[model samples]
Target: MGAAITRAQIVEVADRLFYEQGFEATSFADIAAAVRLSRGNFYYHFRTKDDLLGAVIALRLANTEAMLDGWEGATPDPVERIRSFVRILIMNRARIMLYGCPVGTLCDELSKLRHVAKDDAAKLFMLFRRWLSLQFAALGREADADALALHALMRSQGIATLATAFQDEGFIQREVEDLLAWVEAQRPHQDRPTSETRPQP
Candidate 1:
């Protein structure tokens, strides 16, 4: 194979290792072995672990942006589009159960390590945050758009963490139901006359 393909394969393997075993826990040898590349050859593609990490983060950001863009093109309705965002948990329930939310897990691991790339890794979440905020704003509550986006993001993270901890498929189902209900109730014509408690994730 050409060097470009080899390099891409190394990054792909490294991304999976970083997600499955964590960036701190995964070593260069592990990635090199998984990619079936010699240490010297790996060095030819990436001089340091940070180089691999930068590629992995870039891959993640590209993939996330593509997914969000696909969702936008899939439907024109903002509510259903936002609902599509909320429903990702149900769609990826099995992976979330096994590994927790990928973005959340990466952020937590990087934060704990005090890794300089932590902020860079966090751009994945920002893509989702901005996409959801735009959807909510299009739904006519621009004032609360960011807050709503964060709320949904937090709820998904909590459910993924608990689902991984408890291995509870039923809990995932229940939480998804409540999340859809919450989304369904956020109609543009709805009126709020009094202080209402926010729903728990």
Candidate 2:
């Protein structure tokens, strides 16, 4: 494989390991072994675990931006777009149940360790917060857009954390449905569309 491809593979594996095993618990050798690279070769791609972590955070930020963009492009309705964000709990339920939100868990771990990249990891949540705030603003709640956005983010993190602790699939489903309903209800009464006029995401 080319050097760039090798580096991408290393970052990809490290991202998964960091999410599943955690940042502090996963060592450089563990990631190198998973990527089938020699320690020497791995060091060529990432001299230290922190270097690998920076790459992983970058990858996550890029991927999240792309996802939010896709949702934005998929629908013109802000309510439907916001629904896409809330529905992620249902979409990624299994993994969330297994390991918790990737961004939340990573930020929590890095915070506990006082890792320099804790703020970097938090940018992932910030990314979502900003995106959600825009969606709320588009729906006409400009004054409280950021607060509403943070509320949504807080709810998602809470649901994910509890789901992982309880390992309750039904609880996830129920909470997601309630969250979806809450998102839909946020649409201004004047802006709400009839069932026949509603846009499908």
lDDT of 1 by residue, 15-58 (tens): 88888888889999999999888999989999999888999999
Return model 1's CA RMSD, one decimal.
3.9
Alpha-carbon deviation at 79 in model 1, angstroms: 1.3
Q: Tell how far residue 184 is off in model 2, in angstroms.
A: 0.9
Q: Please list the residue runs of candidate 2 whose C-alpha ends up more than 4 Å from where it truly belongs after superposition.
A: 195-201
User: Please, what is the whole-model Cα lDDT of each candidate in the order they appear?
Assistant: 0.87, 0.92
Worst 10 residues of 2 by lDDT: 192-201
Q: lDDT tens digits, residues 117-136, model 2?
A: 99999999999999999999
- Using TM-score as the measure, the top candidate is 2
Task: Supply the global lDDT for candidate 1.
Answer: 0.87
